[model samples]
Target: MLEARDMTLTELADQVGITIANLSILKNGRAKAIRFTTLTKLCEVLSCQPGDLLTFDPD
Candidate 1:
């Protein structure tokens, strides 16, 4: 979504009020958890729904 919006990670980090390292963790799918506030901010900035950003499938 960032790329689609022509946004850099740094820009997104700033917009989302997080450090680059934290954003990288989320971007890399290495994060074990995400705050609702953060998720809301990401959805707002990325112009996407949670379903567009994350997938759930029980194994």
Candidate 2:
């Protein structure tokens, strides 16, 4: 979605009121959890549904 929306991590973080480092952690899939509020902010900024930003992997 970032690619499709032409958004940079810094830009997204700024827009979402999150820190770049924290967003970077999430981007790297190192985050163990995400708050619903954060998810909602991301969806609103990215104009996407939760499914659009996530995937199911049975690793």
Candidate 2, 1-59: lDDT as tens digits: 89999999999999999999999998888888899999999999999999987766767
Candidate 1, 18-57: lDDT as tens digits: 9999999988887888999999999999999988777654
lDDT (CA) per prediction: 0.91, 0.91
Best by lDDT: 2
Report lDDT (Cα) of residue 32, candidate 1: 81
Clashing pairs in 1: none
lDDT of 2 at 37: 94
The residue-level lDDT of candidate 1 at 46 comes to 94
Quote the lDDT for 27 in model 1: 88
